[model samples]
Target: MYVAVKGGERAIDNAHAWLAEERRGDKAVPELSVPQIREQMALAVNRVMAEGSLYDPDLAALAIKQARGDLIEAIFLIRAYRTTLPRFGGSNPIETETMTCDRRVSATFKDAPGGQVLGPTFDYTHRLLDFKLAADGDVDDAPLGTPHPDATPHIMSFLDQEDLIQSEPQGAETPADLTRTPLELPASRALRLQSLTRGDEGFILGMAYSTQRGYARNHAFVAELRIGAVAVEMDIPELGFAIEIGEITVTESETVNQFQGSKTQPPQFTRGYGLVFGMTERKAISMALVDRALRWKELGEDNVGAPAQDEEFVLYHSDNIQATGFLEHIKLPHYVDFQSELELIRKLRREAQENIMQEAAE
Candidate 1:
């Protein structure tokens, strides 16, 4: 039997007040604005929006402010707020093929179509802290080149033409929304993607690294990695047509893995796909690698019990909210359970002593 602990309402209220004061921190400093955070701390804003599954920069910025710069807490706040809004309907999937690419690169090919535009990336920067940036933090925007007007074709399509890569079939089926329903095993690619996009960045990175270290060695090559903006359109039932709603920046990564072929199938390379909100290349790439690893069963490849290959393991532990709540619950009072354990131990020790005394007397 267990007893519940109670009576902390007053303490809780006082603690919350103290927390709010600490969150503001030193009234002398100027308060941070949402727009400034949305603009200047763009990357952090992007992360919150990405994980929250919401596209509102203003709201994400506000969440960041309320969370006192804690990015994970900001994501949780955004996610909680998002649930209260009435969802009209699902939007049509944005066509990535028609993206206005700002950054595009290929690891397999030196000179890919669109001329390998490295619009903005930190790949070449020397890893040193700039004292000048710390002093004033003012830097001019880098010069831009004329973007290719045409929608850049995916690099994987070239291999697809030759039947040298696995093909993804177009379907009219509506995919499952993990947010609305409990997760079930043998998840579809759509559900898996949803889990990965909103998953903890560090966990996904670690899973991807495990594959590189030979846990499920797929020998992945970065087929293409792109960052760009795409228009979002939603259908109007009354009007009987879809119109452009808005645009959002995104990063997409495609990893080509080793060939999979048997007597029943042709020798063709398989692919892993990842698309994330905003310029999150590392997450996108990491997601792609983990995605491929998780598809071992679907691809008819043997599962050697790799952590990345376990769908239930990956999806179940991905959400930070669930993880945090369970971890924090250990701090709650467990006096009843502790007392039960203590009584059982005492009874077992007493029985042992009585048996020992009888044996000595004999």
Candidate 2:
């Protein structure tokens, strides 16, 4: 519990003022505009948008600037601001199959139907820092490639045709919105996905890595990983039809796990899916690994007691906003609680001394 320490209004005001000054840094350097952050620091903005559970890039950029490039703080700001906004009707599920992919690759297949398009990526880049970039040297524009004429179909669909992979039937039931409702234990796969997508990248990555390191090795193979823009649509009650609201860039990872056959069922490959906002391929891949590990029960696998498999543990601790809030609260005044503990300790020590003295007299 927090004790309200009174009479530091001036100090608080001064501290805030100083913080603003510090955020600006050297007066010689120009201030970072929101557009500059949105365009240049696109990855950071994407992370903020993804974790904040808000799609507004401009607002995310502004939050980043306000928080002085502290992503968690920016996410916190975005989340806080999101709570104040009016809720419109939810958008229809985006069709990733119809996505205009900027980058698409499949590890399972050397040559896929759409053909592999390796878009802007750091996969082949040398790890060494470029002095030219540091000096803000002008660079040549990236050469554009000819766009694919036809829409690329999912790689899993090919596996499905051969009956090689497990089928994922579309659920008729509307998923529970964790934002509107409190997160309950024994969450559905939909809720778990929601939590995972918005979870801390670092925490999720670590959990996913643990699975890879034999915590609960699922033998995941990236069936396909695609980064692209998909149109977001919402059904209009007045029009009785869905219309495109906007488009959002997203990274999708689909992993084919090892075959888990049962006595009653034939052997078939399982699936783990991850879809996140922006070009966050690393987080998307990590999310897929963790997602597969968590599906131990549904897949009729033994509970290995892995940390990732524990639904309650993963969901409860995944949210960085909630985690940081509880953690940072310790810095606030807890004078009464601390004083009570101090007094109890002193009283116990005094009683112990008196008891020793009595024993000596006897």
Candidate 3:
């Protein structure tokens, strides 16, 4: 049986009008400018860009404003907008080693090649929210000391040179794009990273937390976490040389985890890598932990059936857009289904009562 509810057009239009007013809030206050959101709410914009797979701050800011500060909604808007744009050739991979880092830290080594520069961080900040920020959004910039002229070498490279850490073979094959193709189980490292990089922050954080609490424990140490601006370049066929496209701020984290070397391999440390748009260290760190946990099979470790270890589970549930659509779709009218369920329950109860009455009479 099927039932169709009619006459929702006017109601939907009225609801949308109300939603528009709600989004604008009180008219007395000036509407938030896209520039204001971009410059002030930079972190939110960054998250939108990162998840949306687009890195335009202005567009991200506009999306944020349109979404009424709902980050997931903003990301959805950006992703939807991105899908309509014409494709250009891919840019070259960023050289993070040459990045002009604003912040660099190493947990493993006390004094690394570049030295421990806590350029700008909330790591040691008091959690107390300053009410003053509500009145004034201005923040004073701190002075930066002279940075090391030499490139900040990776800590893992040093370990790798000494044969203390497992060396990964460089792959010449181009990685698969998750957006272009359907997700397959037992994804490659590149595919897994693509999923993690765009996955919901809270979901990734929770999965990473599970690993710390002894579920597929990886004993990860932050080998190095760097925040900086890297140059983006693209090759122009006409020019026959790569040209600088633009620069983007990024956070990169490398985690060294405990290893269980097998008969063919010697005892060596393994690594998990995370790279995300903007200065999002927390997300990057969390991403790294989850990435490392997912590589149990490749590392010759037993599968403990942990949430982090399940590629299918992590990859499937990590997408917020997909999750949100299914969750919100439940609100749609299911009158026919409900009616069927109601009749079934009523018939079952009636049969039970009749049986009881007959038994009592006997």
Q: How accurate is candidate 3 locally (lDDT)?
A: 0.89
Q: Each prediction's TM-score against the native?
A: 0.93, 0.96, 0.94
Best by lDDT: 2
Q: How close is candidate 1 to the true structure, as a TM-score?
A: 0.93
Q: Model 1's lDDT to the true fold?
A: 0.88
Better model by lDDT: candidate 1 vs candidate 2: 2
Clashing pairs in 3: none
lDDT by residue (244-309, candidate 1, tens digit) is: 989999999999999657545567899999999988999999999999999887777888889999
**Model 2 alpha-carbon drift over 4 Å, by segment:** 145-149, 263-265
Task: Residues 1-362, candidate 3: write the lDDT tens digits.
Answer: 34566888888999999989998999999989999999988889889998898889999999999888999999999999998999878888888998788889999999787777787678899999978778766666667665445578887888988999988888698788887788888789999999999999999999999999998977999999998888899999999999998999999999999886976667889998899998788889999999999988878788888999989999899999999998987788888888889999999999999999999999
Candidate 2 worst ten-residue window by lDDT = 141-150
Q: What does candidate 3 score on TM?
A: 0.94
Best by TM-score: 2
User: Least accurate stretch of 10 residues (summed lDDT) in model 3?
Assistant: 141-150
CA lDDT, every prediction? 0.88, 0.90, 0.89
Candidate 3, residue 112: Cα displacement in angstroms equals 0.7
